[model samples]
Target: MLRLFSFGSGARLTMRTSEDAPLVICGHGMVAQRLIERLVALGHPFNGIVVFNAEPFSAYNRIQLSAVLANEIPEADLALKPQSWFARHKVSVFNHEPVTRIDTDRGTVTTAHGRVQAYSKLVLATGSRPSSLGISGEDLDGVLTFRTLADTRALINAASTHKRAVVIGGGFLGLEAAEGLRARGMAVTLLHRSDHLLNRQLDTTAGDMLKGLLAQRGLNILTGQSPAALLGKSRVAAVQLNDDTVMSTDLVVIATGITPNIDLARIAGLQCNKGICVDSRMRTSHPAVYALGECCQFGTHTFGLVEPGFQQAQVLAQHLCQTSEATEFSPGSIATRLKISGIPIFSCGRVQAGPATEDIQWQDRPEHRYGRLLVEQGQLVGAVLMGDTASGPWYADLIDSGRDISGYRDTIAFGQPYCEAAA
Candidate 1:
């Protein structure tokens, strides 16, 4: 074993080309930052840590990319931490140098520039990649995806000159992209293959309500449609829909979906499904290798949300520290809360109803308010709200706790204040 300088208290750290590799991490995203912070707080068990980041900048708030695109916040405000923080924590980060290969047998990682780093243990947090539309004209100069800061910057730059923009997909990212482009004074058209917006999160009623609200904000909304091809000579000049209808546009932002970045791990012979397979402890097939965040799959469930990733990061940190309080990761209910073009929306638990489940809905057409509660076995199992979301967090709690709402069932849809007063 070769001894390296320590990161904490000047203790010596050791590694070997054969075994007992040094601690190394790939893909320094938000979840990776969380794990590093936890380890730092725990006094760091390693001599020092090395991080490979594909992005030029250090970890930042990716959740606010749309906000930056909308000009609601400055790009500088997205930074979570500066390089000095990592230096102080004794972390060596290779910014913009993505790992190209993983030599599991040699216990080393090779970078794009051919730099090799040995690790005793490794953590994979490569996150995900935005999926393409898989159609012709997709290679046009103005066509792009909205997954990273670079993508956001490209869209913002294009919006300055592009007069018309078309966004495909009605999911969260797609809606946000449409709204951001509209805020930039572009004539925005949003196309969704589903009958309504946010079909996966809200039922038809709520989805329709959201669609109407966005349309009222001057966005051209087209439902149950998808682009057959992007049309232009050099850059995108128009989009051709499946019905053979064409709308002239200068830019196209595709937010279809994301696929986990599992190629490196998969090539290394690690178990991978939709993502890198991990046990409850975030352990991969190899004992010395672990994975977390969007790159990890626990059982049949894969994570796309940050909350689950945060939970996984915490569990992995504890297990690696060998703390007494270390616990297994269990998937839990996650809520969706979003604001598109200044309109608030929220949904949690089961948006869909099962045979044994019942749905109680409320609507105030004059007030432009709507709510729905899913009850199963007399417990609040799901909820969706639009227009007025002050009760969103409270509703989420009830769903998470599985509390019986039978006593206040009649007034539950009215929100927590009324339910509390009535009880």
Candidate 2:
């Protein structure tokens, strides 16, 4: 039997069958929600599902957060599922309650509010936390990190009064934040410690092209610079750089990077390196306890992208539901698509070529378009497309399939259709 009672705003109490322990899930983010949805679709028993969400609201699309910050979409519109959906599925959700302690021996987890839940199986999807520069005055009122709906709201509120904004980090998230602030009618300056923007995803030439594109869109890009300290009395008013250069700003947004959330796993004595160590099946060091999403590491890889996490969720769901066709998790080349400032960009696999690799380049400078293919032994190893990304999927397919393109090398830079026509 299942019983439910309301406590207060966004808080709920539920009782499940004492006979079979429920499956306890921590962190109600996109990956966690996907797992729940997959289980429900597999016709898994609903009485076994219990979720702990630290956020006040249900799972939402974090990918659209930039739109929210730009005032293009309301926060309420980003929810992945409604409150009624949980009720319909008979899944108990304790909103605004985080699992503080995991007792593996006792097979239980305690919530922040002193509630204890027992579980036959546990899944950690705690996700990642925004990284800070560890500089002085980061705790100032105007210094913020873009990670959640709350953080977006804070930026929106700060932008209303602040005229100048400085965004730290030149990665995808930093660029998105800069663009969102620019869209809000604020003068934005982007600071990146690397020599080029998105150094991890793009080569130097591609990064330079992106910088030029963003500069044309009114973003001030400063590469090879890092913040030494944030200066303000009660709030941030300026940032001091490594070279002792101070730039004035009303608000500061840090989009440096993210650190995987692993405190709970560590406390529970689970094996952890950069993240919680999990097998290809998403099983943790403890059999009953499993992990997935950004908080879990499989082999040497930890995912920050949504596709890999979603794939892991599917595999874990199949395993948990005891599906007959369960498959082992196999990672593929991750692709990245930038969503900002109306600029189309796609990058996948190795953008940089090794000594033995062949590089094919096509540049249409007049149209601000560039494309490159990295080939090794007649197979497509990687690709980068900028300005026009219509052929991104085709390039990705070529890389994924490891197809031999020797015959089409002459016109391959023109993309798939042209290559096929030439063939």
Candidate 3:
């Protein structure tokens, strides 16, 4: 039996739950919702299903939160599953109530209200929170992190009264926040620590081009800069750069990164590294407990994308339900398709070319369209597309299949249509 833990208060539990054990889930984010849907789709074996959601609402598309912030989509459109779906599925939901303690020995979890509930199987999909930069004035009123639905709402509310915004980080979320804020008529200043935007997903040329495109669309993007401190007496009113340049801002959004919610798993004595350590089947160290999504780590890879989490969900569902389709989670290459500040972009496989790789470049400067292909050992190893991403999926498939593009080397940069026509 694993140890007992009451998160945050240093308390010990001796009581046992009398309620019947069922399939219990902690956290109701997208990954958790996907797991449930897969479980149900495979004819779940559990007697009952129970979900504990820390948020007021159930599962919704967190990715579309940026669209909501930008007013591109209505708030109600964010829901992935309706309230009636849970009711019809007989899945019990406890909203705004989070599991505060886990007694592995008792196979029970306790909520903040001291209501103990037993579980036949427990799944940890606790998800993650925005990463902190540890700069000064982070506790200020107008300083916020953009990762949750609540954060989006808060930012939207701030935008109504605020005239200026400072977004820290130039990654996907930061760029989205800046665009959304700008759409709301707020002046936006985007700051990034790296010299280029989307540094992890785009090469220098693509990154710099993205910066220029966004700048043309009213984003004051500053690369090679980081915030030294957030200045304000009670609310964040300005941000000071490392070079001592201070800019007035009504709100500050920290989109640095995400930190997995692994405290519960760790405190309960489960094996954990960057996240709750799990196998290919998504099972934790404890036999009756499993973990998936951003909360769990597979090998040295920590998931930042939903595709991997969905793959984990499928594998976990198969294993738990003992389905004939039982399979392990084998992460493959996933492409990045994004619309940043109204410009289209896509990238897959390696973003940069190694010394052993060859680069095939194509550009239509007048149309703002560009493509780069990296061929290694006669196979497509990487790709980046901007302005025109109509051929993104075809490029992604070629990279994933490791196809020999040497036959079409001259026309590969022109996209699948040209290569096929040439064939």
Clash tally, candidates in order: 5, 0, 0
Q: Per-residue CA lDDT of candidate 1, range 195-241, in tens? A: 98998788999888888888888999999999999999998889999
Q: What is the TM-score of each candidate against the true structure?
A: 0.93, 0.94, 0.93
Give me the displacement of residue 61 in model 2, in angstroms. Answer: 0.5
Instruction: Report the Cα lDDT for residue 153, model 3.
Output: 94
**Candidate 3 C-alpha error for residue 184, in Å:** 0.5
Root-mean-square deviation (CA) per prediction: 4.4, 3.8, 3.4
The residue ranges of model 2 lying beyond 4 angstroms of the native Cα positions read: 1-19
Task: Give me the runs in candidate 1 sitting further than 4 Å from their true place.
Answer: 3-21
How far in Å is the alpha carbon of 357 misplaced in model 1? 3.0
Cα RMSD for predicted model 1: 4.4
Candidate 1 positional error at 206, Å = 1.3
- Across 1-423, the per-residue lDDT of candidate 2 in tens digits comes to 555645447677675534477888999999999999999999985356899989887889999999898878888889898889988988898989999999897677889987978787899999998987889999998999999989998999988988999999999999999999999999999999999989888888888988988898899999999999999999899999999999999999999999999999999999999999999899999999999999999889988878888999999999988899998887778888875577788899997889998999877865778888899999989988888888888888888889888898778888788887877
For lDDT, candidate 1 versus 2, the one ahead is 2
